[model samples]
Every structure is written in structure tokens, then in C-alpha cells.
Target: MVMITASGKGTSSTKGTNSTKVASSTSGTNSTKKASGTWSPPEFDESLPREVTVMEGEPAELPCVVFKLKGRAVSWIRQRDLHVISANGLTFTSDERFKVTLDNATSSFTLGVAEALRNDSGVYECQVNTRPKLSRPVSLKVLVPAARIAGATELFIRRGSTLVITCTAQLHPTAPSKVEWVHNSSVVSISGGRGGVSVHTERGGPQLSSTLSLAKVEMRDAGNYTCRPHSLTPASVTVFIVDDEVPAAMHHDSGVGRGGGCPLPALFYSALAALTCPALCPALCPALTCPVPPYPAPS
Candidate 1:
């Protein structure tokens, strides 16, 4: 025969015919329940941003917030190559630019990369040591803005004529604040000694354009013209001024032309030949009828 008794302390006693046994199985179970009920696993704060953007050559920081961390360790991993960058606020990568910082008060683990480059743009993961692990993904973007002229890399303009040059800058994922024009290594300004010089800028979404105009441009105004954007590569175009000796038709071309086309004055002179029709009319205008010249009287 066996008899069992239970007490408030979660202890149990069993009495047998030949022996008495006391077991505290329920006490162990209660202790386990209490411990589990008092502790919670780490979890990420979903309110924080998951995407970050920064300009090339600038610093980039990605933050991960985790609460109820207890004693769990945090790590940052680069998803591009599954490379471990840092763990428990200690850097593991060979790159000196990568660093990890933790704020105990806020429970934020931040991964910082100095002097970010275009190649550094990718998704990174912050992990907390837990069963199956708790992770949050963050994306980094590195932008590189560049500038280009509206026309060709070289321009030709007639002296004493209005010269206009338009420059366009592409600032992706960012808006351009301003564009500066440099003429022959000197910054161009409307208030400068060169009168009638004007610069007009307009913004259209991600592209910013600035037009430079010089009224009655002189030969001295010919040189390299560059459009420079803030912290970005500048674009340049060579400007050549034509003298009065060069016919207007010789220098006038679509902004992209290098003044290599056949001169209009030559075409005008050819048209005059068609009127005379001295056997050259057929070559100038195939549809024209040339009058036959009377053979010189047998002399």
C-alpha cells in the first residue's frame, strides 16, 4: 500500500509498506515557472528607421534598438558578404573605418562607418543572442552626385555675340542647393568687372540647371568653363571665340557643334553661280537648266 500527501511548500511525501519517501518534484516545477515568468527575451523596437542615406565621403550610422536584453550580446553583420563587422561593441573587421557603439540607457546598438563610399551601400543586420536569434535589418545608401553640360564638351561662339551655356547637375536621392560657375579657373560673378554677365539657376526635382549668359562676349572671354556642384565632381567645356574675320555662318552652330560644318557663305556663293549657269549650274543644283553658251565664233 502507498500513501501520498502534499503541502503548501510544494513538497510531496509518499509512505510505503516498508519505507517512507519524500519528493519535492512540484517545488522544482514551481521554481522553474517563477524563473521563466520573471525573465523576457530581447526584442527590437519597431519604431526606429530601417533605412539610412548618406552622401559619399560622409559618415553613415545605423541604429538598432533592443529592449529586455538582459545579458545577451549584440552584433553587426554585413549582409553583402555575411561578414561580421562588430560584436558586443567590439569591432571584428579589418577595416578601421567600421565601429560599433552602444547606449545602455536607450539599449541602442549603432554601427558607424566613416567616410562612406558608393561600394559601402548595402543591407546590414543587427543580431541579439537568443534562441534562434533576434535580428533587425538596416539599409544604407551612399549617393554620388555628378554634373554635366547640356550640350557638347566644346562650344564655339562669335565675338560680340551673346554666349549662353547651360549646365545640369544630377543629385540623386538629394536636392542640389546651388551650382557655381567657374570661368578659366576664376569664379564667375554677376557683380564682377565683366558687365552684362548673368547667371540663372532653376531646380527641377532631382536635377538642377544653371544657365550662364555673357552679352557681347569678347575674345578674352574664351577659355574653360566649369560647373561645380557642392562636394561633387564638376563638368567643364572649352569655349572658343571667333574673330570678325570668321563669317558669322562659320561660327554659328547648334551648341554641340565644333564649327566644323561647311560655311554658309560658301553655299551662298554657289547659289550665285547657279544664276550665271556657266556649266556649273548642273553641279550646284541638279534640277537647274543651264543655258548653252554660244561657241566663240571660229576665232
Candidate 2:
């Protein structure tokens, strides 16, 4: 006798002259096989908030998170008109107020502008380094408080002359912002809080103004000075100061002040001026006058 069994049903037997056979019925059970090579990574959620906003001199935070970030790195970048303001984990901005911060799961990059200015408003980008690069860009609009300079920004002081810089900034809501005179890279004088130095604000967005005075100016005070408004994204304006005497000779010649007669001096000065000036000569020194030769015109 022989018996046969199927996966689902019971066994059955069949008998012949010298042999018996049994077979099982295949009733409800079903079997299916799946291939092994059809696996893929999870899809990324690219529709998160990509833009942020903050007031001038205020601290702003940008958040970036990824759902499928297994082997990727996060990077933050600030995209100005034609420049990358910030990149990688470091800051590349000429402005000292911008900085980057990273978290365990999310990336929170913070930009602190001591006192926000009109120029501080722009687009900031957040990027993820993965097989397929992912990026999110946010637009930041900085609201500058009502502020203006009341006195002379450049002062011609002798070795021991007195110098004073007056800065006035006004903001809506009339919260008193900090005002200080920054000499070189360090704080030389501060006013406003307690007795250090400062000005008061009034109601209804009144214009606030203050003066940073240097009773006796010295050679050491011959660098760049900035009036910073201490607030959440503080705004600052730089004022350049030099000794009473003119520069002996510029590192490079800029033709700007070398007017009248000496082509060599003019050329030299122009070159130096071009290098020093933030913008090139074609824009700053449009009307350049050349020196005439000693010989008179033939009559």
C-alpha cells in the first residue's frame, strides 16, 4: 500500500492488484514565494519649513530636520546675491553676528545680529549631504529700528585731541537698546545701562540717539569703530578713524586723491585706491583728472 499527502487536505489511499497508493487533497492552503533583491531606502520628507524671520539685533534660529538621514551630514549656508555667506559648520560671513549651531537629531543654526540693519535681510539656506543632496532656503528680513547718526562720523584729532561719536537709533515699542563704542575689536567705551553708557527711548517709536565721546584721542584709537545696538540681532555701523596726520604713503597707490599733473602718481594712487576701496574705481572714481604736461600747445 502506498499513501500520498498534499499540503492542505488529508491523505488518500489507492489499492491495485499488488500495490496501494494514497494521496492528499489540496484544499484551502496557498503558497507564494517572494524575490529577495527588491529592497529600497525610505523616502525623504522634503516639504518642511524652509524659511525663517527675525528682527534686527535679534537672535534668529533656523531649524532643519531629515527623516531618512542615515549616512548624511547637515550643513547651513547663507545665499547672498552672488556670495555664500555661511557654509559647512563654520561661518563665512564678513559680519560677526552670524553663527551656526547643530543638535543631535535636528540642526538649529542661529544667527545673532547684534543690531539688525537693512543690509542684514536676505536668504539663508540649510543643506543635507546625502546620496541625493537635499536643501532648504529661508528668507530673513531684518527690521532696523529708527536710527540715524547726528554728529560727525570722522574726527580729525591730534595725538591728544578729544573725539566723540554720536549714534542714535530708534525702534518701535520704545525698548531701550544698548549703545556702545567698539574700538578695534574690543569695547573701548559703553553707555546706556546703569552708569556705563546709554540713551533712553520714548513711547510710540520715538527716535533714540546717543553719543560715544572720547575725551582724549590717542594713536591707539586709530582703527575702525562701530556703534552697536545690543539687542536680539543687533545692528552696527562702522566708522573709520585715523590720526590727525595723513597716511605717509598708502600701501598701494589709489589715484583718487592724486589729482593734477603726475601721471605716475595718479596711476599709483588710483591702483592703491582701487585696492583699498570696497568698490572698484570704475564706480567710485568716475571723473578722474589727468595732469597736463609742462610744454605749452604749439600756436
Candidate 3:
């Protein structure tokens, strides 16, 4: 036979044919447990940069700083395409250009894009999956540099003719605020004299556009002229003017001068021909290298 007994204060039990006492008892008080330490979710840095500008072909960085992380995760996403770029300090994008670096000391999860392109200009988001899901939007702006002259690379005009050329630059509306005209690599200004050069800005286009004009072309203007603008790659235009001596040579006057042949102007034309021979000048070439001017003598 087996016997058992119970009460509010305690309990006991026994089992046996001879009443063997396999006893058990219970106490009135319940077991106690210690409370755990307080924990908080991660938070983002408030003073993060809202907009970042990086030049094209360079690397861009978007920072994601968190406080009191408590084992939370950080992630970066491309807002334009909604593609997950990085998660938990690991890169999720298959692109080799995308990477994530985590700094344990500063709790910074910065996303890096290498060799940035013009198409990469857009908004990106840095997110922390915390209790409230903290996030900060960072706008990435990519800048591309470009400049070009919109006309024939070289222009030929007769004396007393009006010469006009235009220069246009991309990625800037009024870039190169100052335009300068250079001849033979020497700075030439718009002198207040007859047949002078002048540069004027035209406001008809979105990008920056400037027009350089010579009111009346002359023999002295028959050299390589450079169109240089501030913060832009300079372009050159070679202006060739026809002289009366050039035509006389076509009429069996190819010999020496005054003996029924061309004059000094003919030598100038010949020099130009030799300098611009098909074997010398490439099809798509820039201005010729100017001979350095002689050093000025001390006064």
C-alpha cells in the first residue's frame, strides 16, 4: 500500500508494502529571481551631413552613426532603386564598387562607393533597425566637369571681316565667370582701339555660353587664339587671314620677292603649309605649340 498527505504549510508522501516512507515536503514561500539590467536601442547622430558633394570618378562616403547600439544592426539602402546595399556591417550588393566599413570605437557604419559616376548622383539612406527604426537621409551629388567650343576648330577670314565664335560649358550655368582671349599663349585683352577683340555672354541657353568677337579682323589677329575661362579647360582657334600676296603666287609668282614672285607674306604662307602638312598635323588636333617669346631685357 501507498500513502500520501498534504497541507497548506507542508506536504509529505510514502510508498511500500511495509509502508516504506519515501517522504517529500514543500515550503510555503515561492522562489525568487533577480531583475535584469536596463537596456536601450541605438540612436543616430543628429548633426549628420544632409547633403554631400563629390566629384565624379571619386569615392563617396555616407556615414551612419549610432549610440547605445545594444547589439542592434545598421544598414544602407539606395533610395532611387530601393536596393539593399549593406546590412549588419556586411555588403549586400553584388557590385564591387559598394562596401561597408564599421568602426567599433565610434560606432560608425560608413558606406563607401568607389569610382563614382554621373549616374550615381542621387539620394541614399542610412538606417538603423532599432526599437523606433532610426534613419537619416543623405543626398549624394556627383559633379562632372566639361567644357567645349561650339564651332570649327580653325577659322579663316578676310581682312576687315567680322569674326565670331562661341564657347559652351556643361554642368555649370555661369561657370568661368571670366573669359579671357589669349594669342600665342600670351594674354590678349580687349583694348579700346580699332579692330579690337571683345567677349560677351549670351543668356539663351541653360549651360554657360560666351561669344568672342573681333569687330574687324586684321593681319595681327592671324595667330592661334585661345578661349580660356575660369575653372574650365581652355580651347583654341587658329584664325588665318588672306593676304594679296597669297593669290599672286598662284599666277606663276612662286619665286623670290620683287622679282615677280611672292613677298614676305608668301614665306608666311609657306611656313604655315609646312607646319600644317598632312604628315605633320593629325586629323583631330589641338592648337600648335607656340614658340616662346624672347625674354624681355631689364630696363
Candidate 4:
């Protein structure tokens, strides 16, 4: 007599011949085959941008795109402090400036920061829930807008000469909205017959220039000139309109008093006269003898 025993279902023991019958069932199937029929694993889209840039005080957005996301959750973490900023379209940070948004059409999770500051620039991670926890790093750069005049803080332009001053505004990743010129606390105009004054602007990349031109600079044009970039700190330069004809008897070289032995600092004779002399130093600049060197034409 011959006997055999089968342990589990889908297995049959036969006593008649040297043969056994087995039935294939799902319970005995491979795990990979079972998973193949379920939802696909989440994968990050490599074609999307891996870095973001924005100007200070502007809104900044970083995107995280995934393929076959299914029910997986997406999160944004600030790498600077390893702080969780948002997860699954919900913000976890206390700061009201940070927010998360989800787009079902493109399977994207975006983190937005309003009024972005320089301190907000850093690496951020886009995380997706998975067995191993998949993540992608994205870099953020924030630039502060800086506006400045091209020349020195103080300038002297000879009367009847063309005065060309340029103000350059820089805001990396973006451009300044507007640039304006102010003369002696009054706004300068490019048109309306405003004393031959004109303004020209040009932009390239992150930097732009605004040129203020005066056809024939006169005494009236001498004063404080300010360049104001919209929503940015304004820069000012002291301007002096000097006469082309210098006094024959007076020689101003290193303050070596030649006209009447009037001893004055060399700074008084320099282009910085509007800053250090005439009004501020009346003792050194006598009205009759020293003659307060004809620097800025009398207002």
C-alpha cells in the first residue's frame, strides 16, 4: 500500500498513480503580482524646476510635482531649520506668510511665501510618503532691491554744460517697477517744458538704469538731487553748478591761499563745497576778502 498527504488547499493527493494535482490560487500567488494590480507608487517628476528665485517683499512659490500620486501625501520642509512648513495642502508653521496649495490637474503641491524676505532664502525639501520616504531638494534665492546713483555723493557740473546723471537699480530675479528723479524736494518732470530736462530708462536682466539729462545745466539746477526707485529707499546726491570762468587773482590748489592769504581747508575748494562750506563755515569764508570761492551759484 502507498499513501501521500497534501498540506494546504489547491493541492491534491492521489493514491492510484505516482501523480499529484495542484490548483493555482491567489492565496499562493507571488506578492509582486498582487501589487501590480494596485495603485502605482508615487514618483517625483524630474522635468520640473529644482530651484526658485524671487525679489524681497515679493511672493515666492516652490513647486513639487509627482506622478501617480494616488492617495500619497506631499509635504514641504524648510531645510534651514528642518522645520515642517506644510503637509498635504495644510500649513504646519505658525507664520502666516507660508501656505500650501494643491493642484489636482497637474498633481502639484506648491508652497507659497508672501512678502518673501532675504532670510527666507534657503533649501527646501519636497517629501512624499512612501516605504523609503522619497524627497527632492529645491533651492530658493531672495534678492533685495538696491538703488544707487552712479557717481559720487556730491557732484559739480559746470554751468552751460550738459549734466548727465545715471541711477542704477538692481533687484536680482526681478526688475524695479519705476524710477523717478527729484530736484530740491520737488519732483522733476520729463515733459511739460520742464527746463530742458529729460529722462531715459533701459533694462537688462536684473539691473536697469535711469538717466537724468539736463541740456544746459544752470544755477537753478544746483541743489539736492534724489533718485527714487518705486517702493525702495531713495538715494541722493548734492549737485553744484559752478561757473566756467574762475577768478583770475584767486588760485585754489591744496588750500594754499593765494588771493588774499585766506586760509581755508582744501575741502572748501573741492566739489564737496555744498557739504562743508559757505553756509556751514562763514568764519573761514569772509564775504569780502576770502570771497567764499564761487562754487555753487547763489540760489
Candidate 5:
């Protein structure tokens, strides 16, 4: 006599919906043939794995094994709505994300799920039709990963300052396979920074973090920087570089006063906001009470 075992799987196509729950069961029935002494019903093992965990959008496998099935059917069914997904290695639903494979050498039936969704989380059953029937239950759990930046979403820094960005992935099973930084939608070379660019990563519990550091940053670095992980959604931050040039409103006694090459005269006008005569506003006069400080006299 030959036994059989099979697993059931559900695929997920959407973020919050798990399309299939892969469930697996093993059979304990003995493959020994007697001289017509007695007939034993198919034995189902309940000690098999009852819980399976997988990341969303990834494939999941469920296995069901039946020993000494001896011309019996192995099938998988959803416990929530009692929907039969596969029967005797044949698919019952039109969902192409699911498929069953039966191996004669191992007497094992396996279910495969592709692109798993969040809604596919549920209990699945592997069943062997017999006199009273036999069943094994397994639970499917889906995990979703989220990405974030440790510092502010937007950043402002002076030129020549060191730049550090930390990207953290929460609820991830492991660290991202690849982490890269992008500037203004273009890939930033890890080795192309002024003071050199370096990346370091650490894992703590279920959270994984990677830090990108650029030394002696410059104005060209000012732009939208994005932290992209292969598995999670990318996070972005805007970088603004403060200029080193002084504002023109402040000038020394070199006659380079408000009206003398003072590019930002608006600073004076803004100070005399209460002046009704905009053209004759004394605020524009360098000797007058200007809003901005006058440049220091030559030593």
C-alpha cells in the first residue's frame, strides 16, 4: 500500500490581502500489506508544523504527506470559507497563483503560492477522504515591512558639514539585501563623494538599519536624497545647503553702504515698514537706522 501527504498554499497579490494560505499535513499510515487480515484507515499526523510564516509578495509552500494512501485522494481546503483549492493534485480555483505537485517517490503533495498578499492569512486544512475522513490544520502568517529615516524628513545643513542619513526597516525578517542612496532620482555613487561615502548596517531584533555617511558635503549634494531598500518602500529627504557668502545689506564705511553695491536693499526697506514715503524712506540710508548691521570698519 502507498501513502500520500499534501500541503495547501494561498498566494497574495495585494498588500492587505492574502490570496492563499499554504497548509501542509503529513500522513502516518503504514505502507504494509496484510494477507487480508484487516484494513486500517489513513492516518494523519497532527504533530506537523501548524504555523508557517512568510513575507508578503513572496512565494510560500505548504506540504501535505500521506503514507499508504493506497488509491486515496489528498486535498487542501480553506477553513474560513470552506473553499477547496486543490483535489488530488488538481486545482479547483481559477487563481493561477496556486499549484499542486504530487511526488510518487516521497508520497508527498505540496502546494505553491506566488505573490502572497496580506489577506491570505488564515487556517488551512489538508484532508484525506476516508470512512470518517482525516484532517490537519496549519496557520499562515504574513509579514509586511516598512521603511523610515531616523532624522527629519527634510534637512538643512551648511556646506563642508558631514552628511549622515539613516534608513530603518521595521518588522523585517532580515536586513535588506541591497541598500543604495539616490540623489534627485539618480543613483549616487557610494565611492564618489568628496570626503568619501561609507555605509554601515546593523540589525537589532526585528528592526534593521543602514546608515549612509558623506564627509565634507558640498552644495552639489543639496537635493532630494532617497534611501532605497530592495525589499521595502524607499524613503526620501530634501537637503538644503546654506550659502557662505554674506548678505549685501551689511556693508562697511567704504561708501559701500545700502546704495553702494548693496544687492539686498530690500533689507533696508523691510526695516522701515512703517514709512509711508517708500522712495524717501530713510531706512535705505546707510547712516540711518537700517534693519541689517553695517559691516565692521577696516582694522
Candidate 6:
């Protein structure tokens, strides 16, 4: 017959049942924890944009994109000093030219720089704030209108000569580009800054003019000269110099009169006699052969 056990006698049976339930519950909790831990969140792809070119004094746009982004932040940094230019859809500093525009769906960010300067030429980096932090680097080169001398040219000066050459070119933004004299393509004799040279900018559109001068001429200074304009093409020209002395013989001859070598009357008579001989010799045939006067020899 089925009978209910008393509390003290049933203690061992209840204890065993409770222990089995506790073991099962502990195993279920451990399995659930492991499942949750195994699932990983999607990561952001931090990659910099490609194919970017900009001109000097013009606006530049740099694009940075983050793909598969879940909960990560994006940042833009200049490579020079790892300076943070922009971050997380917000500009940290109040620089008027720096702006960030984002395309939420495409996960792309664009950094705009207005009126780019020479200092803006460098590498830009894109970063994603995720585990291990994904990053990509891009290079930006700013091009200004420039001209340089073709390698086929050179400059020269003769001994005891003057050094004179012209370096000419055109530039953008209506400012004069620097013109420098490069010797052997290394030694910088004159540049835009202070020294024995100077640079002057005339108000004209994209056109630059400059001249290089050697104040005191020397004999040893004769050689090839190159005119290189700063950030522009180069032009080269040759120079020649000579000593000021005149030859002594040339001076002596200068004093002689045009007819000094022979008298005019003597010259006329000699011409007349020569003409008469051809005709008279035929007529004076036989014993009357004309005794030709030894025509007065040309004085």
C-alpha cells in the first residue's frame, strides 16, 4: 500500500531529489552563458578614401568610410603630428575651414578644407573606434601651377665678363613664384629670400617675371647657368664677355689716308697706259714696234 513517510524519515529522499534538480539548473545556466558569450557584434571597417587630388588655393574634400559599423566611432587625423582634426560626427575645435559631412547609410565621412595652403600637403588617416581599432591612411598632394627649365639648357660667362640671365614663368593666384639660380643642380646661389638677391611680385594674372644679376664680373665665374622658378618651370640662357683692350696695329692703320699709298695722278696715268698698249701694239708692227715706256711703276 502507498503510504506517506514522516518528516524525519523522508529527509534523505528529499535531499537527494533537491540535489539532482540543483545540478540540472546549474548546467542550464552555464549553457546559456556560453551561448551569449560566443555571439560577437559586427565591426566597423575603417578605410580611407582613394584617388584624391587637389589644387592649391582651392577647396579639398577628403572622404573616409566605415563599413559594417555597429557601435563604433570614426575619427580623422592628420599624419604630421597625429593631430585630431575631426571626430564622431562633430568637430572638436572651431576652425572655420574644417567641416565633417556624413552619409549615414553609406557609412562615409567627408572632411572639407577650404582655401588649401602649402602646409596642407600631407597624409590623412581614418580610424574606427572598435576592438583593435581599424585604420587606413591616405596621401594628399597639393599642386600649384609651376614651370621649370628643360634639362637641355645651360648658362655660361666668358673670362672678365658680366653675368646676366633671365628666369621667366607663370603662376596661379596672381602671386609671383620664386626664381632661383641652381648651379650643377645643387648649390642654391640665389633664392626668394634675403641674400644677394630679391623677389618682386607685380600685379598680373598668373604671369611671373624675374632677373638674376651678378654685380661684379669675374673671369672664374664663367660656366653654365640655370634659372629655376620656385614651384615653376626653369629657363636657361648663355652669356659671353670679352676684354676691353684694342690691338695696337688697328690703331696705327686708322690714321692712313685713303689715297696715301699712291698719288691720284700717277694712278690715272698708269690706267691710261695699260689700255693703250693692247690697241697700239697691233698698229706698231715691224720696225716701228713701239718702245713702251716702262709705265711708271705703281707708287
Q: Which candidate number maximizes lDDT?
A: 1
lDDT tens per residue, model 6, 147-169:
54332232322344445555556
Cα distance off (Å), candidate 4, residue 121: 3.0
Residues 1-299, candidate 2: write the lDDT tens digits.
Answer: 23334522232222331242222222212211223344344333456555655555566665555555555565666577545545546776777766666454553444444555667677766676655666677677766664455543333344555556666665544466556556667775345232333333233344555566564555455556666664523334333333334333221233234543334433443444534542333244444321111233234
Give one digit per residue, the lDDT tens place, for model 3 in 1-299.
Answer: 13323442233322332244222122212221122343556668878887888767778888778888877778888898889888867898778998888998998888888978889889888888866677788988988765577665555566777778787664344443666767786776677455367778654443666787886677777788776766667887666665432333222323224453334333344454445553221122222221112233334
Task: Pick out the ten consecutive residues of candidate 6 with the lowest summed lDDT.
Answer: 247-256
Model 2 lDDT vs. the true structure? 0.49
Model 1 error, position 21 (Å): 20
Best by TM-score: 4
Q: Report lDDT (Cα) of residue 120, candidate 5.
A: 83
What local lDDT does model 2 show for residue 94?
A: 73
Error of 5 at 103 (Å): 3.3
Clashes of 3: 0
Off by over 4 Å in 1: 1-41, 148-195, 200-210, 215-225, 236-299
In candidate 3 the C-alpha lDDT for residue 242 amounts to: 50
- For model 1 the local lDDT of residue 208 reads 79
Winner on lDDT (4 vs 6): 4
Clashing pairs in 4: none
Candidate 3 residues lying further than 4 Å off, grouped into runs, are 1-39, 148-299
- Model 3 global lDDT (CA atoms, 0 to 1): 0.65
Instruction: Locate the minimum summed-lDDT window of 10 residues in model 2.
Output: 23-32
Clashes of each: 0, 41, 0, 0, 32, 9
List, residue by residue over 1-299, the lDDT tens digit for candidate 5.
12222222222233224322221111212323343547767765545577888878778887778777888998899899999999987999888988888897766777778877788888888889886888888788877766788655546556777888888876445554567778897887765535477888777776678888888877688778888877678888776554443234333322234455433443344344334343333435543333322334334
Q: Which candidate do you rate higher for lDDT, 3 or 4?
A: 4
lDDT of each: 0.74, 0.49, 0.65, 0.74, 0.67, 0.57
Per-residue error for 255 in candidate 1, Å, reads 12
